[model samples]
Target chain A: MANTHISYTALPGRSRPYFGVLYLVELVFTFGLLAIGERTRLYLGPDHLLVLRRRFFTETAHRFYFSDIQAITVQRTTNAVTANAVLFLLCALTLGVLGLYPFSGGMILLGDFSFGEELLLILACAGFGLGLALNILLGPACVTELITAVSREPLPCLSRWGTAQRALALLVPRIETAQGVPSPEFLNVQPVLAAYATPAGRLITQPPITHDSGRLHELLFGLYLLMSVSCMIDLTGNWMIKNAFDSLLFMIVLVLSCIALLRQRHSDIPSDIRSLTGFALGFSVLLFYFTRPFTMLHMFWNMPENFDPAILMSSMLNPDDPLYVAYVGTQLAVDLFVGLLGLLGIYRFRRLYRLAQHNAALDTPPPPASNVEEPPAAP
Target chain B: MSTALTAWSGTACPRCGREMERLPSNSVEPRVCPHCKTSFIALLFPAAVQNEFLGRYGEPLREESEAACFYHADKRAETACDRCGRFLCALCAIDTQDKRYCPQCLENGIRSGELPEFQSAYPRHDLLALAVACIPLMLAIPILLIVLPWATDIALGFALGLLLFPAFVTAPASLYLALRFRKTVTHPLGRRAGWFPLTVLLAAGQMVVWAVAIIVFTGSLFSEF
Candidate 1:
C-alpha cells in the first residue's frame, strides 16, 4: 500500500460567489480583490481529504478517508451563466464611463475626487475587468461532491469544470490506491446495488411532509410590492402623500423578507420563488445603502455652522438634493421591478407547490381512513 | 429518522433522484444525467456493490446460558457497550470509530459532545488572531482613503492618530489570541500553524509603530499647552 500520510497538496479553487454583494464592502474598505468571500478550501492529506470551511470566526474541518470514499460526482451549475452576464454588463458600463471621460473634460460628474482618488477608482475598475476575464476564462461552473457510504460532502473549491477534473486527477489515484480497483466482473455494474442499498427502509423519493409555510412567500412579495409603491409615491412628493410611512414600510419588508427566506429554505416551494426571495432581500439592502456615500458627501458639503446631532440625522434622511433624488429614484424603480418579479414568482411557486402536494396526496395510501372505516359505521 | 439518514450513495443525480450512469473502472469522462440533464461525473467503488448491512435483527435466545440483550430481552447480547457497560445486541450496538456504545450511550455522547469527532464546528483561534491583527489595518485603509486627498499633512497626522489609538487595543488583543489559541487544530496541509505566529509578529510590529506615533503625538500636544 502506498504511504498515504506524508505528502499533502492544496486543491485549486476557493468556495465563494463569483461576486458577493459583500465584495462591495471589501472594495470600498480595502480596495483589494472584489471577489473575496467565505473561503472553503480542500486539502489532499495522507490519510484523508480535509475540507477547511471558514465562515466568520468558525472553521469546520470535515475529513473523508480515501478507503471509505465510494464515489466522486461533479455536476454543472448555472452559477457560471449568471456570473458571466453580470460581469459582462459591469465591463460594458465601466468601458462606457472610461470612453466618456475624455469628452466630459477633467470634471467627474459623480463627485469631485483628487488625482490620487481617481487613480484608485481606475485601479478598482481594472480589478473588476480582471474578474470578468477570470470568470470567462474558467468556463462553466460545477459543484463537485465526494460520496462515502455514510456521508456526501461538497468540495467547494472545485467549483469549475476544469478545476474539478484536475481535482479528480489528484483524488482518483489516491482513492484507487487506497482501495484496489474493482474486478472486471463488476466493472460495469449499473448502480443495481445502490438501488438495493437505498439506505434500507427509505424510498427513492422522500415522503412529502410539507405544511403550508403560512403563505410566507405571498406575504413577503406583497410587502415588497407595498414598499416599492410607497417609496415611488414618496419620491413623487405629490399632494397628501404619506412619506413618513416609507421607512416603516421598508422595515416591514426587511423583516418579512428575512423571515420568509429562512422559513422557505428547505420547503417544497419552487426554486425560482426562493431565488426571488433572496433577491428581494438583497435588492432591498442595495436600495438602502447604494446611495449612502453620495448622500454623506452631500451632507458634508452642506454642513451648517452649528452641526447639531438632530440636524445631521434629519439632513441625511431628507437630503433635499437633486442628485439624491436621481440616485434614490433609480433605486426605487428597480425595487418596484423586483417586487413585481417576486409576485410573479410567488404565483408560479404556489401553482407548482399545490400540484406537487396534490400528486403526493394521491400517491400516499390513506392509512388512518383504512384503519378506522369498516365500510359500515354502526349507524 | 431513517429517511434522514438515507446513505447518499453516488448512485443518482443529486438534484433529481434518477439513477446516474456509473463509470466503469477506467472511464473518467463526465456525463449528464438523462432525467435532470445535469452534467455529472460519478465513480463507484467496490464497496458500492456490497451491501453495507444484511440485517441487524438480533438472534433469538436459543441457549439459556447466553446473556440476553438489555434492550431486547429475547435477543442474545453480542457486545458490551463501551461507554456504559450494558450488554447490547447487534441492533442496539452503535459502532463509531474505535468505541462501541449502546443506542442510549451514543445519543448521550453526541448530545453532551463527549466525542470530539461529532462536534460540528468551533472558532479557530488562529483565524481570530488573524482578524485582530489585520482588522485595524483594514479599517485604516478606508479612513486614509476618505481623508488623505483633502490635505496631505492634516490627513497624515489624523490617520496616524486614528490608527495608533486602535492599534493600542487591537495589537495586544491579537497577541493574547495568538498565545491563547496556540494549540488550535491547525490546517491539515501544515499551512494551518502560521496564522497565529504571523498575528503575533504583526501585533508586535503594530505595537512598536503605535508607541512611536503616540509618543510624538503626545509630545506635540504637551508642547502646544
Candidate 2:
C-alpha cells in the first residue's frame, strides 16, 4: 500500500571518481569519445513493476505483475572480470617483452609539451598495472534477475547490489503472498498465462525484433561488392585472365550471400536460410583462402618499380622478390583473419535463425476444439 | 472476507473481453466469464496511500516568513543544497541518494568531476593497448609516403626501422592487451575495442617482410661492392 514510487538509475561501477579523471585525461590527450546513451529506469506500481529503457532513438517499456513473478535471484557475472584479467596479463607480458628491447633516447613533442620516450613508456605501463589491480579487486559485477515461468527470458531488475536488494525487499513479499493462494490449477497456471495472457499481450503486440543483423549483412555485402568491383576494374584494365576468373568467383559468392541474407529475413523455415547462409559463408572463406596467392601476385605486379621491362617481368615471376614476399605474407594474414570472422558470423546467424523459429512457433495460434462428444459429468 | 474478493470485481477476462464475476469457493479461485467460457485470475490489492516523506512546494511568500530560495526569490526554501548550502525550493531541488542539491551546485559538481554518478563512460585500458600496438605502424604509412618516392636503400631502411618499433613493441603489446580485455561490460564510446590481435598479427607480418627485405637488399648491395 506504499504510495511512494521508487526510482533509481543503474550506473556502471567502473565510473568512479578516479576513473572519471582518467577519462577526462584520455579525452583531452587522445581525442576519445565516451558518451552513455541508453538508460534503464524502474517504477514500482501498486500491483505491478514497470521497467523503462530509454535509448537514443526509442524507449521501450515492460510491465510485470507480482502474480507472474516466480522468484528473484541475485548473482555476480564474472565475464567482464575474467576478460579484464586476461587483458592485464597480456599487457604485462607485452611490457616484459618491451623491456628486453634496447632502449634508445628520443623525445616526442606535442604542441608546447615534450614527452620523453622512457617517461611515456613508464606511464603506459603504470596505467595498465593500475587497471589490472582494479579489475582484480572489483571481481565481478552483480546482477539481480527476476525468474518467471511465463517466458524463457530472464528479467534483469538491476546491476548494483543496493538497488537490487531494495527492489527484492519490495517485490519478494508480494510474490510470496500471490503464490500462497491455494487454487485447483496451480501447476497449469504458467502455461495458461503463457498461452493466453503474457505472450499474447506482449510478444504478439510488439515483436522484439532487432535489425542489427540485417544492417551488418548489408555492410559486409556492400564492402564485398565494392572490393569485387574495384578488383574487376583493375583486372579489366590489366587484361589478366586468372585475376578476372578469381574476382568473378568471389563476386558470385558475395552476391549469393547477399541474396541468402535477404531471403533469410522473410523465410518462415529456419533450416532453409541456415543452410544457404552457411554455404555462402563457408564458400567465401574457401574462396578467399584459395585465391590469396594469385591476389598477392597481382598486387606485386602492379607495384611501381624502376627495373627494365625484362627484369620487371622476371622479378614478377620470381616468388623471392623481397617486397612481393612481404606483400604475400601480409595478404595471407589478412585472409586468415577474415576467414575466422566469417566462421563466427556463420555460427551467430544459425543461432539467430533458430531463435526466430522458436519465437515464431510460440506466436502460432492453438488448434480449434474438435466436435467429438464428451461423457456426462458425474452428479 | 468477501470484501477482499470485491476488490477484483471489474476486471475483464483476457481472452473473451467480458466482465468476470468471482465464483464462490473455499480459497481464491479464477473468475469465470459469464458471457464466454474463458476464465482469468484477477489482481486484488489495497489502493496505494499518499507518500508523506516528500516535501510539498509552498505558496509564494508575500512577507518572507523564512529564508527564500536562491533560484526563486518568491518561493519559500524547503532545503539547503548538500554541497553549496544554497537554499533550494522544490522546483529547483534535485534529489540524489538522500541528499538534495540546487541545479547550479549539481552542474558544478558534475563539471568539476566531483560526482561519479554523472560520468557517462570510463576510459578503456584495452583501447590504450591497441593504440600502442597500432599507432606506430599507422605512423609508418606517412613515413613511407615521404621516403618511398625518394628511392634510396638507406631511407627505406630508416623507414622500416621506424615502423619496426610499433610492429614489434606495440603490436605484441596490443595483441596481449586485446586478448586480456576481450570481454567488456559496457560500451565505452558506444563501441568495444576493434580486433587488436588481427591488426597486431598483420603488423608483425609486415615487419618480418620488411626486415627480410632489408637483409636481402643489404646482402645484394654487399655482393655488388
Candidate 3:
C-alpha cells in the first residue's frame, strides 16, 4: 500500500493591525473587556481534513472526512455594520456637543477654568472620537460557510478570499477523486460558485432566510414593548399629557402584539396577527423618530434661562442630579440608536413573518374534495 | 491479469461474483471479468475490496512453546499491544483504526474520555462561554449583598472591587472561546451564543458607572469640606 502521509498547511496569515489597536484600546480603557485573538491551522490527510483552532486558553480540532462533505459553498454577506458604526458615531458626537455646551457655560461664569477639568474633558472627547473613527474604518467582517449533508447547520469559515480559494482548490479535487464521479450536489451549488467567481465583487441577491425559530423576533418584540411602556410612564410622570396619551396608545398596541407573538411561538401564526405585530413595531419606531425634535423642544423650554453657569456645571458634575446626567448622556442620541435597532428588528421580524406564512402555506393540507351534493350526480 | 493481481487487488464483478482483472497497460481502465464478460470501475468499491483482502488473520499456535498471553496464561501470545506492550492471544487482541490496544488501555481511554471516538458530536462553546461569564458573578454577587449593609466606605470599596474579577477573568475567557469557535459550522445549541460579549460589556459598564459614582460623590463631599 502506498503510504500517504498527512500534510499540514498553515493558512496564510493576514495581519489586522486595526484589530490589534482596537484590542489595545479596549484593554487600556475597559480593562481588557472582551478582547480575543485566534490562530487556525489546516491539516490534509489521505482521506480526511482537520482544522485546528488555537486561542489563549483553549485548543479545539474539528475533523471532516472526504466522504462526509456533501457540498462546499462560498457566501458573502453585506451586513449593516457600517451603518451601525455611523449611528454610534453620531450618538457620540451628539453627546460630546451636549457635554461641551455646559462646559462652555462654566467658562462664561468662571472666566478661567482649572487645568484638571479641561484635561479630563479633552481626554474624554479624544477617546470617544478615536473609538468612533476606528469603528467606521474597520468595515464589516465577512464569513465563509461550508454546508454538509450530515449537519443541517452550515459551518462558518472566516478567511480572506485568496486563502479560502486555495483551500477550496486543495479540497474539491480530492473529494471528486474520492467519490470517483462528478457530484450532482456540486452542480447544484454552481450558482454560488459562479457568484463568487465573478469579478464584480458584489453579493448575489438572495432573500433573507430566518433560521432562529422566532426567538430573536419574540425577544425584540418583548424589548420594544418594555421600551414603549417605559416611555409612556416617563411622559405621564413629566406632565407631557399629549405625548403620554400617544405613548399609552402605542404601548397598548405593542402589548397586544407581544401577546399575539408569544401565542404564535408554538403554533402557526395567522397572517393578520403577524401583520399587526409588524405594523405595531414599525409605527412605534416612526413615532419615536418623529417625536424627537418635539421632545428636545420641550426639554429646552423647561430649562431655567437665567441660572448661573457655575451652578449648572456643579449640578452636571453631581451624580445625584439625575436630570443633568440624563442631559449629558445624550438620551436623544441613545433613543435614535435604539430606534434604528428597532427598525432593524422590524425588518427581521417581517422576514420571519413571511417565512412563517410560507411554511404555514406549505403545511396546510389542500382543502378536501368540496362537499357538493354528489347524490344528484349519482341519480 | 497475473501482473495486476500482484500490484492491485481488483473487485468482484457485480454481475457474476467472479474476481475482475484490469485491462493491460491501462491504470485507470475498467476491470474485466473473464468468466462473466462483465466490466466495471473498481475504484467505486475501493474501500470494500481493500478491507476484504488486507486483513491478515493470526496463525494458530503450533507446539505450545510460545510466550503466554498476559491475561490468559494458557493461551499462546500472537502479538503485543501497541500502547502497553502486553502480549495477547488472538481472542484478546483488539485492533483500532491506527493501533492495537490492550483491554486495560482501552478501558482507561474510555474512562478518561481522551479518545477521539468518545468526543461529543460538536464542541459546546456556548455552554463554555456562559459558564465563564456567569460563574464569577454567581460567586461575587452573594458576597457583595451580604457585606454591603455593614460595610464602611473602605469596605464597600473592597467589596465593589471584587466585581472586577468577573470582568477581567470572564471577559477574556468568553472572548477567547468565541473567537476559537467563530468558524464552527455546526452548533448543537441552535446559533452561537453572542451573550458573552454583551456580558463583558455590561460588566465594564457597571465598573464605569461605579467609578463615576464614586468620583462624583467623593468630589461633592470634598467640595463641601
Best by TM-score: 1
Tens-place lDDT digits, model 2, residues A15-133: 32232334444444333322233345565555666565543323355556766664343443433343454345434533642353333122111111122233433555676676666
Candidate 2 regions off by >4 Å?
A: A1-253, A262-267, A275-279, A282-286, A289-294, A298-379, B1-93, B102-107, B117-120, B123-156, B159-225
lDDT of 1 by residue, B1-225 (tens): 123323344556655556654554544677766643567777767666665666578888999889999999999999999988999888998887788999888778766758645654555677677777776667777788777656578787877677677788989998998988797544334444567768889999999997887799999999999
CA lDDT of every candidate = 0.66, 0.48, 0.48
lDDT tens digits by residue: candidate 3, B1-225: 011101112233433334443332212233445543433332221121222233344445566787888988777788899878999887778887787787888778756655546332344464455456555555555566545545578766665666564556665666566566655523321244465566556545555655787799899999999
Query: Over 4 Å off in model 1, which ranges?
Result: A1-7, A18-38, A104-124, A182-187, A192-379, B1-26, B32-38, B54-123, B151-158, B183-192, B213-225
TM-score, model 1 to reference: 0.61
lDDT of 1 by residue, A233-335 (tens): 6565532235556667778878888888666644555545655666556655743553454345545655668878665654444434343354456556656
Winner on lDDT (1 vs 2): 1
Q: What would the C-alpha RMSD of candidate 1 be, to one decimal place?
A: 9.0
Per-residue lDDT over A68-175 for candidate 3, one digit per residue giving the tens place of the 0 to 100 score: 554443333222243334445444544554465464555322233334334433554565566556545644333344433223122233333344555666766676
User: Which 10-residue span in candidate 1 chain A carries the lowest summed lDDT?
Assistant: A191-200
Q: Is the docking of candidate 3 incorrect, acceptable, medium or high quality?
A: incorrect
DockQ of each: 0.23, 0.02, 0.03
